[model samples]
Target chain A: MSKLISCYRGAVDAWECDQMGHMNVQFYMAKGSEAFAHLQNALGLDPARIRKEKRGLRFKSLRTQYKSEVHAGSALHGIAGIRKLDGDVIHGFIQLFETAFDRLSAVYEFTALYTNLQTDEALPLPGDLRDRALALADDHPDIYQPAPFVGTVMPARPLKHMFESSRSSVDVWECDIFNHIEHRHIVGYFSDAATHIMGSVGLTRHTVRSRNLGSAALDYYSEFHAPIKMSTPVLLKSGLMGAKGKIFRFGHHLFDLDSGEIAISTTVLGCYFDMTARKSVPLPEEYANFPAEKVLAKQL
Target chain B: MSGYVESYRGQVLASECDLLGHMNIQFYISRLSQAIWNMCYFVGMAPEEIKGSKRALATVHQDSNYLSELMAGDIIHMETAVLKASTKTITFRHRLINSATGDPALTNISTVAYMDLTARKAIPLTEAMKIKVNELMVDAEDEA
Candidate 1:
């Protein structure tokens, strides 16, 4: 029998889409969050146990590749499985499909650790947990495995020219049952930071709209360094990674203000698309105007 | 054999829980309702086509078992398969499972009649619909 598990099945709600005419990147992270819960369950870390013990599998690193766009009213289903359980870290993946067209919409490849939910402390993998995960682990050669994140990846260091794109305290509602900020909210911060980054490049909603262009995230790689609990003061610093041809890349360092530590490091890649034509287009002329010395790729 | 195919996948929201601290009975049915639509599509009753033709599969009878309590944030999914089908009606069974525990939360069996929305009356199943029903049929004894 295949070790793979069908972990998610749901449709896109109309409200889940943003102005981009398709489901937003944050909503994809939301579904990935739900899928992660189930994957943890399969490893003997069910909800009741986690809520009682206050510990469960938490992602150390996650890479999301958006393959195709899904619109409102689209049905989505996902399958997840452990590729391997090595030492304290378990490698796994979740692939979400657009049911109507039977096409892969997005996939999340992740490395997780059983951790102290409150402290973000990695715990020793329990014997029973290791056994269960190993029993279900497989090569899963039939599934799609993306090439190691295509271009320059983000590092967890504060960059010299990185500017504050957003600063606020986490909200209670932005957390999951674990009381830690949900991955969707973290992605939300990055999504909103797009405006600030664009502003730095001398572009705005008016300028993009005048060109009938819409931006879409093509790939995202995030590394969680520490947990951001509810009400924690947070700050996001961002800098352009690179902008050339039709693609532009940006990097972020999300800081936990109280601890003065980088909570998460993320690299995002995306492109502008002609709204009416529904096709990717060249990076706006404005992107080239950003000071070359300010680009974070210099440090990377 | 087409034993069961997933019809629904989601999480329980905190608001959906009753004062008892588990998911409410109404929410179980609501998730089942979402499953029904997906099951219809599996049986070749594409929702868009049904919407255009003013035809739908309306449940005439149903029975369910709430075997386990579902807490908020619980990841859950449902799998369903056809039990039997006549010219005018099809009976199907859905098994809802808690993704974390791999325990059955609920099992719903529904008998639905093909209906004409405008006329508000049951209608006979089409040949293609019958073919899909047969393709999705599974043995009940083996399911349990």
Candidate 2:
């Protein structure tokens, strides 16, 4: 089926799988996010230029359906089409299919807000882009007809962990057609959680920023036990796992608290430093008050 | 055969890039693990063999160093050799090499514990299997 805009091929590499030997869940978001980038570039929305122009597009919301599993060494193709466009926001629908069988593996329907890049404030969609997007939607009605997976059941039991922090909704400027949370946003979540825990110990965001992100290496892997779409109000839990010398390990998990399912679990490794001189920093007195024993007991 | 047989090949696909167009770091680990699987299969510890023997290999620790950039559609090979084999665990070293030039691309060292597949508990490596794997051990000088 042809849309005004259409499918792009993706290959499943060995690295996309988990111990279960299938594509990890977060990758659906990752791949879908990749497709959106291609779509935007095709639509004349150069994110770099937008960033340079200080006029950005952010994802206000996203919704996704993972109907099947993609395995290592498989080929997948994503088909996409725009649905509607208001002045600044664009709504779109996309499908990821296994090229081997042409079976639908995942579907995403999302809304994104255009924003003033410089101010990080929402902006109205240009009339020309809106018309182009609507014109594209009309080409793929059969596929665009909404078959969304609303109200799906959450895991019967919540997969809660002590050391996870829930994420806050993007403040309007972070939304985009890409749909997946931006890398900075993911890092910001941990930073916020660190601040929260630090705040409990009497350290403030201002005091911490003086050190900057000296050196941080985040190793994150999230299995898509299920799909989480945009605007789902997902819960994130984060806590410090351990700190030795200047290195600290943080663990985070994202949950669909409503369904009690663990959507993703992540671990981040970081080192504290002056960042200005590129040297390690000593643990602050506030960090001395960290709840270590309580945190280690919950590690999975 | 004196030792186990191992074979590996790197993935070549364009979709592996992240938003930055570089191979995302996390997926790199997954690729390394798969290479280890291929090495295991070459050594006669195929999935069918493991299933029949009711034994499994579970990773305990992994250490890796990335030397250079690897891109999508680049053909590479991960050559694996058993570094050490003991009663309960086996240590392995894997080198990711360019398929065309045969140059080292990345290095990974991992330890895996043998386990009773059914009970999911660690088990001792049999003498015969140990000897077989030792034959496949890459000489120390050849490791680099």
In terms of DockQ, the best-performing candidate is 1
Q: Is the docking of candidate 1 incorrect, acceptable, medium or high quality?
A: acceptable
Each prediction's DockQ against the real complex: 0.34, 0.02
RMSD of 2: 17.7
**lDDT (tens digit, per residue) of candidate 1 on A1-300:** 988877788777667889888998899998888877777877888788888988898898999999998876567888999999888999999999988778999999999998988777899999999999999999899999998998888888878999999999998768766678888889999988988988888898899899999999999999998889889999999989999899999999999999999989999999999999999999999888878998889987
Q: Return the top candidate by lDDT.
A: 1
For model 2, the stretches where C-alpha displacement exceeds 4 angstroms are A144-148, A152-300, B1-144
Give candidate 1's whole-model lDDT: 0.87
C-alpha positional error of residue A106 in candidate 1 after TM-score superposition, expressed in Å = 1.0
Cα error, residue A68 of model 1, in Å, equals: 0.8
The clash count of every prediction, one per candidate, is 0, 28
Off by over 4 Å in 1: B1-4, B13-20, B24-30, B45-68, B81-95, B99-127, B133-144
